[model samples]
Target: MGTWIIDAIATRHDRSGFSCGQPSLDEFLQTRVSQYQRRNLGQTFVAVPQGEDANNHRVIGYYTLAASAVAFQNLPLVRSRRLPKHPVPVVLLARLAVDRAHQRKGLGEGLLLDALQRTQAIATELGIYAVEVDAIDDSVAAFYTRYGFAPLLDQPRHLFLPIETIDRAIDAAS
Candidate 1:
């Protein structure tokens, strides 16, 4: 296992090698970065070697967190009824990708776990309701599901893990 130092990209200058390894992600960054700038909705957490030239950093994996909403109508029946009618403030785990070179190193899972931990902390501090993610594909959806995420409503690709769920998972793991 490789030692990774995880930290937020504090400035635009810190965004080196932040492009997604996946093509869809690349396009989103190219076309959407500017439009989404005002909201600062997109965030990147870079993982670097414990001790190396920071500029020579390779983004082994990254996941973006954003302020997002999911309509109550789009939530699962059990969750929907429990939520308010209007859109709720959600922390979106929008995209996550691991570099091809680091494919089997468990780095992807580490990034995800870090994302969840950070989001959960934010939710508690800011009173957000849920941590949501839009899975890029069925396989990605399955990965989140294995980690206790549930599909929102009938939308198989949109999933969420409530703060309680996250807490339970952490407790179980510990």
Candidate 2:
């Protein structure tokens, strides 16, 4: 509602103008997004630039979410001991990117908050225990940590935030 109208990626979202400064991410959107969605590998939500004519709504950013799991062994001892000996169900925040033109203007945070809200809502019906993200770098990891994500003891780049934390944050904001 700021400058974006977020929605599931559609054929008419004007996909040609996105470039997030990451070649892989840019290429993924340019070529792989549709195939991945068709194969059910992931679901991408794109943020289209609002205020433009209906026929020219440009995509400024996007994020992907998908069902995923974390092996019990990967969890911290304190956490792993409390759960049954099995993989924990989680929602994966697979990819998130903002176009270069939209970077440094809070679009990344907006995308992340949207992803967190969606994961929190979907978990109640889907039985997810947590929302997980694999950070692309140290800076990305730090960003998630600031948002209350805990790093995996075995894998620093992998982070998680429990559903309870999401609930608390929403409650606090409300």
Estimated TM-score for each candidate? 0.83, 0.95
Model 2 scores what on Cα lDDT?
Answer: 0.88
Off by over 4 Å in 1: 10-21, 27-39
lDDT by residue (tens digit), candidate 1, 1-174: 358777764333233454545787755544554455457768767676577675565555667788888787887777767666988778998878766666668888898899988987887678777789989889889988988888887578888988888878877887
lDDT of 2 by residue, 44-130 (tens): 999987777887778899999999999888887766778999999999999999998888888888899999889988977888888
Alpha-carbon local distance difference test for all models:
0.74, 0.88
What is the overall TM-score of model 1 with all chains considered together?
0.83
By lDDT, who's the top model here?
2
User: How many backbone overlaps does candidate 2 show?
Assistant: 0
Candidate 2's TM-score: 0.95
Top TM-score model: 2
